[model samples]
Target: MNVAPNNHKTGKEADTASVANYRVDNFTRLVTYSPRFLLMLLILPVLSGLVSVLLPAFGWAPALEQTRFGVQGFMALWQTPGLTQMIGLSVTSGFISTLLAFLMTLMILAAFFNSVWLNRIERLFSPILVIPHAAAAIAVGFLIAPSGMFSRLISPWLSNWELAPQGILPHDAYGISIILGLTLKEMPFLLLMALGVLAQPELGKKLRQQHKVALNLGYYPMTAFFKVVLPNLYPLLRLPLFAILAYASASVEIPLILGPNTPPTLAVAIVQWFNDVDLNLRIKASAGAVLQLVLTAGLLVLWLAGEKLVKVLCNNSITNGRRKYHDKVWQTATIGLTIVILGFVLLALIGLFLWSVAGYWRFPATLPEQFVLLHFQNSFMQMSTPLFNTLTIGFITTLFAITLTLLCLESEQLTTKAISPFTHLIIYLPLIVPSIAFLFGLVWLQQLLNNQTAFLNVAFTHLLFVLPYTFLSLSSSYRRLDPRFANVAASLGATPSKIFFQVKLPQLFAPILIAVALGLAVSFGQYLPTLLAGGGRIATITTEAVTLANGASRRTSAVYAMIQMVLPLIGFALAWILPKYWFKGAKA
Candidate 1:
């Protein structure tokens, strides 16, 4: 009788194990092939956009009733005034800004790689990242403008001038101001990427060991980092550097604000062409878009060549076997640059706040004569619609992006297979390609498809940009999570889905929130995508701010820019605060 009962119990246990295995296998099969399909979905739009633009460049657009393909568009593009100057400006500004940001990133790492100062700088990254590019450009312009805050602070005491000085600071011919603005924005990104790499436990330990070995050999700390650690670190940074180069080369917003007007950068000029009342200019604009694409690619190629040159040049120093050199000057300079760059950003933001409330403020006064909410009150009625649209799009775009990213990452974990290198490149396509190039084409294609301008279309376009950033933000934390927790849960009869939701998701709450904030920021900063995708029907704070920035009303523009800056900051704050409160409640 006892033998019979024991046998029945064993049979029941076996059945349970079999069912669990079946569920796990079913889940694995479902997600295994999803990535390939998702990759196609992501790539098709970019390819279609490129094709749509290509036909117009050849003077063939059926919508325009000119099906004959020829070189008319290219010829018109070449004939445009200041064409050469626009291309030259784009190339120079892109290269100079990227180079400066990269060097500064290295200097900061060398000076305070594992120190408290480094930690402090890292803390400031969130605020800087939250500030939209348009807002930042406006703030930077105000702070550095000839009669702006910096000048007012030093005028009577040092310069002895009462009236605002006439100087072409922000809109200088060579685009110096554009470069400064780009550098301030790009450094945080590059530094963040580097820090992520350094934060990997195994890699960080190895780097520490290598750093120590070099120091023991009598090499100075800074020199040791360049010779030993940089070779490893730089390869990982190559993709981000390329992405930065692409943006700096063809960016429309900063250039629109700070670039010369006689002939803006190629990208900016293309926008003007597309927006012109003369419809024939659309074909020319298409050609310019194609040229801008080629220009950005050429810039990347040149950057690659520069990379080789730098490697060879640095290799000579490594061979010299120099043990010690005076690094104090270099360290001091690094610290000073860090302070100036951070100070400039802080003061620029403050300048925006002051301008928003100033009443009859003059050039030589650091403070407004009398602060008032008159500007805000005047702008509120106009600002209401754009603010609603911005929030709606930002939330919708972020939600979908986070969901898709989670699926992709979860699929990776389930299959125990990472995406191939080629697939990874495809995901980064939206970022590496200049938005002006494909977006210009996409706008025309949307018209051809009779796709109405709506929030869904705008959100979809925003997803193309937002998804990559979201994945990058959350992937590291997700992948590094311990497997034991899942194993233990599975042993308790949990299904794959259950472990994913209850076991894994809870552990990843903070990172998920962070990714959400990053997605919102990326969406909020989009200017061209929103304007083009929505066919000018959609007005986000970014688009409105950019428009107002170019207008004569500084106070009204400040009001819009301030709103743009605040939305992302609010997202980041929620990400930080929610986790603490939720976990505290759980503990209680």
Candidate 2:
């Protein structure tokens, strides 16, 4: 009787274990087949940061002893002296910069959409994508400053001057310098985005053929491009356009270096208030942050309105059936202007290189009279710690971000449900939102959580910022991957894990490296996150460059800026070369 009862209990326990194992396997399948949980995890930080800003905008920062909610912060913010001028500067620079970038992008596509010029333009512009916005701004500043290389080269030859002509080139009063600086930096990004849009297989060949058909129907090249191709293109470009608008409106480092002092751009002013020694100004800064969001939204609305106006204008041109306008002239004009822009960028970077080694260099001389390694040696020693910290943070954040993105994308592949538009918005939220509005809140959250590891804290913050870009960079190749490769592996009885590691990952190695390089660039370019999360206890090449720009030591600043350029270049080079070598060896 005892043996019979024991056997019965053992059978019952075995059944229970079997059920538990089934449940566990089912849960694993559910997670692997959906990205719902991952989406929530990614969106949580963005939501938290918004809430943190919203409360303080109403004067409710309890830590600062202002526990009450009111509109005092907003009142103070609007009442700031020269507030209207500041808003105008922000709007004008943002608008003009975005408009120019958009028009230039359209013209390039119109004129050179499928030609050799287009191919060469893309190849040349690819490297510009890796140049950080801050570095580009610094480079432009060096090139255009009153005492800068351009003036130095022209001096005594064309113009007789022993001293730099002040109030002439950079940091001018009307913010033209800022506008120009922003346009140069933004053009490459918009062009890159346009290339991606135009390069889509469905759009690529079909659109070119459509343009040719329209041209054959008595439409000019620019006219045909507008009537035949651009309507399809604009819809795709809307999000990236909004991103540029937001960035130009809330830009900090660029405006700081190139904007006016008497009334700096609104973003710069807000940063100043946030960093003010008086704790009460933090509320003002918060109010300003909210205003920045509103300002960016307003600019986007205006752009949308302009789109409607352009539609009407283009409709008139397209239907009027007049075919004799000089499309070649427009093409030539755009090409010349683009060449000028590229020339400026090249000269600017070369100016930085020249300045870094310059010693006892006086005004009115094109080349340095004396060159030395002193700046490099000194910068090397001073930046060693920060350099290591930057590398460590970049490595940690990129590794985790790439892994997370891969998992989410892989889940999408496994599921029938496609990643939704709302999910794309989640990925773009960090880029759309100004860093000032939420980064401080992030700093507060970090302190509250007692996350004292500065490196980890900063790396995590960077991961949030970097993940969206990494996903964008990699998602295209990932989603478009040929399913037949996996199908073949499965036919050979390969498990899902083995197929992923052995087949998909190897095939995607190039895009993976490219995504990593993009992430590394994005992290290196971060300023506000590093400043707030690291609590000024950490420094990187970017922060050092921006800080050094405030001082008059051009040599020191150049050294830091050049160093910032090098790390990303190495990443880009590897991304470019590795795949070729790997495939070459595979054939061998």
Candidate 3:
């Protein structure tokens, strides 16, 4: 009887082991395949979108009844008036703005590394990072236009003029305004990306140690950062740098607001062509879209060349090992410039708020005549539907984006394999490719399949952009979560799913929520995706704000812009507040 009992116990144990092994194998398979699925999901749409544009560029659009393939679209695009100027403006504004933003970012990092100044900068610039491009453009317009707040602040005092200046301040001939606006918006992004990378505990410690070594070796702080830190740092930042370059090259909203009208940047011109009344312009627009892709790619190539040249030129200076290369003067200048740039952003925001509440404000006045809620009161009703749509889209997009990001991160843990570089590129494709190029084609595909699902369609499109940011925001923290927690959970007989939900997730709650806020911010800022994918069937705060911004109603535009700006701020606030309360109960 004892022998029988022992055999039965052994059989039961074997069965249990078999079941556990099966589960483990299954989970591993799922995890291993998840990245592949993500890559397919991201790549296929981009390819289809590209193909959709390509067909029309070659004159093959059945919707327009031109089914034959030819180069007429390209010919038409070539012959467009002031085409050369458009190209030149796009190249100049894109390249110069990106270069300026990048240089400013490097300067700030070199000047303030491992100091309280760096922390102060991080705190200040974080909020600016959330402001939508369209809203920022509007803010910049209010701040810098001839009749803008800055001009008024200086009028009849510094310059002795009672009236607004007549020269082109915003829509200047050389596209300087576009460059300034883009730089204001982009520099914060590069700063944040660099900061995030440096915030990694291990990497930051190593970098700090290296800096100390450089200091001991008689290198100036800035020069040490350049010689020791930047060489290592720049490679890590290559992807984000490329993203900034691509965005600066082909962004539509800022250029639309501030670029020259005679020959706007090729991006704005392409948008105009697409929206033109004549259907023939659609084909030409497709061709222009292709050209936009080419132009952006060319800009990237130029930037790469510049990188090589800079490396060659700096090689000697780097090796010379000077103790002090005017470090204090350089630091003060960079710090001053950083404050000025951030101050411009802050003043721009204040300008938006001031305009929203101003009543009968006149020129040369520092403050408004009266701060009234009339604009808000009058515009509240108009804002209702768009606000609702914005919230809905942002929530839906954020939820799915967070879910997908968490899943991808969890899968990495389960499989013990990091995503490959190719997969990384796929994730970044949306950011690096000019949205104007493929989004139109994607919209066309959506129309053919079923445009009636505008809400879902728009959310999905937002996901394309939002997911990348979401993943990037959350991945570092997710990966950095101590593995021992999971190991302990596993030892305690928790299933992978259970451990993921109970242990890993609770620990990652703060970062996940921050990622949620960032995803929402990204969704709220989307203009082309929402506009193109929604097919004008659905309106969001972004669309409404952009529309008002383009119109003559600055006050109304400010109201919409304020609402747009506030939504993301609200998301961030909740992200901050919820974590404190959420864990308080758990801790108790």
Candidate 4:
């Protein structure tokens, strides 16, 4: 009997060990396959959104009871007055702004690279990067409009008259004001992206060495950069530039404030169609959205063609061996222009702050005659709903984005296989496609699901955008993580999961926090997605600020814009500080 009892105990121990081993194997497989699963999850909604838009364009949406395909929707869109102008504006503004922003980014970097001013310039632009596009446009309008602050300051004195000059650029029919707004906003982004690209230490050193060789071979500094460094740099920046091109083309808020209204940019027009009281206009809006997508794609193709042509021209120039170009003049001009742009941006922001406090200042005066707290006091109560919605939506979306992004990134690191190029393109699709196009489709989708809560729907839509940017911001840091630390922990008998939680995440606390902050900023600044997906039921600070900009209430508008700008600033400030607090010895 004793021998039989001992045999039973040994059998139970063996069974338990077998089960545990199976579970461990399952988990390892899960970690290895997580990226593909996550990517499929991200792609499904986008594909559905696109299909939903395309169906309506073809006059076949079940929600509106158009069960058969027809071209009626497209017919209506084409027949609309000023459609040509709208597309033209969208195209020109996108291409021109992107071109200028790209050039300015290269020039400024060339001028400041390895200089004492390099770090300082980057830090100074941090706040500029945080400023909301709507707020910037509003502030720019306040300064440059016909009866604007600039006129208030210099008016008749500079003009040798007693009245203000007609605003030359503020709402010019050619969309000049819109271009300026886009260029200013996009420059910081391009610069940030370029700086990120240059982060690899060895790559940086190699480029510097190549630059020296060219200089020694009698190549001008700028020429050497254009010939030697640019070939490598452009490929890295292509994704960001394409994103800029897409954004510039389809932007809603900035163009609405600064662009001409005869036929506003295609994005603005499409938005108006959806917003129209007549619900059938939504079909037309969907059609317009499809056209906008086509237009954007065309512009991208053109950009690629332009790249080829430019490359051929550059090769010829390099072959001619013109080594004595005027690089000093180019450098000085670039630095001077960048400084002026920054100065104007600073002044525009100050104007927003000042207007928020002004009591009743008349035009043609440099400063406010009397400042008061009335605007702030009046705004405090009315701003509650929008502010609440903004906070709730921002938090939820940022949480979702950060969680998903971390999972996919961690899985990629743990996996033996490399993440594919196609996966990278999927990550960028949202940034490249016009939001005005996909967001309306999302609206119809919500209706089909009978989704009533604006807050949830809006947050989900924001997540689509927030994820791409969050992923981009955190990716480089995550990939470049030194594996030696984890290897050391493993040698000490730590399991992979334990090492990841204990060693990897703690070391990466700073980047993780920074990514969250950037995601929050992206979510906070979103206007179109919030406006459309929320169906006007949900209001955020951005929607309110843009609405306020439409009227003659300068002080109240300024208060709203100031409020809009402040939220992101608060998020970024926390990002900058909390990383140091958590990881005391780690760099933020």
Candidates in order have lDDT scores of 0.87, 0.83, 0.88, 0.84
Q: How many residue pairs of model 2 clash at the backbone? A: 0
Q: Which candidate achieves the best lDDT against the true structure?
A: 3
Per-residue C-alpha lDDT of model 1 across residues 1-588, encoded as one tens digit per residue: 445444444778899888878887876665676677668757987888888888898999887888999999999999988999999999999989999999999999998865777878888865887788899899999988887899998988898879989978899999999999999989999998899888888888898799889989988888888878898888889988999999999999999998899889999999898888887888999999899899899989988999899888878887799865578889899989989888888899999999999999976888999999999998887888888888899888888878777778889988788988887888888888888888878778888876765677788789889988998898889889999999999899788878988999999999999999999999999998998789788998999999999975888889988988888888889999999998998899
Query: Please, what are the lDDT tens digits per residue for candidate 3 over residues 396-422?
Result: 988987887888888888877788888
TM-score of each: 0.95, 0.93, 0.96, 0.94
Full-model lDDT, candidate 2: 0.83
- The best-first sequence of candidates by TM-score reads 3, 1, 4, 2
Q: Assess the local accuracy of residue 508 in candidate 3 as a C-alpha lDDT between 0 and 100.
A: 89
**Which residue pairs show collisions in model 1?**
none
> What is the TM-score (0 to 1) of candidate 1?
0.95
Candidate 3, residue 357: how far the Cα is off, in Å:
0.4
lDDT of 2 by residue, 1-588 (tens): 455444445778989867766765664475474466557656777678778888888988877888888999999998999999889999999989988988888888788865788879888877777877777778888988888888888897787878888646677778898898888888888888888777777777888899889878888778788777888788988888888888898888888877887799898998888878897898898899888878888888898898899888777776677875788889789889878878888899999899899998888889989999899998898888889888888888888788878877877776656688998877777777777777767676676677678877788789888888888888888877899999999899765656677989999999999999999998998887887788788898888888998775889988888888888999999999999999999999
Model 1 root-mean-square deviation: 2.6
Candidate 4 local lDDT, 310-424, one digit each (tens)? 9877778866888856889998898899889888888888888889999777667767899999999999989899899998899999988887777677787677455688898
Of 1 and 4, the candidate ranking higher by TM-score: 1
lDDT for 319 in candidate 4 is 69
Q: How far off is residue 226 in model 1, in Å?
A: 0.4
Clash pairs, candidate 4, are: 152-364
Spell out the clash pairs found in candidate 3.
none
Which ten contiguous residues of candidate 2 have the minimum total lDDT?
1-10
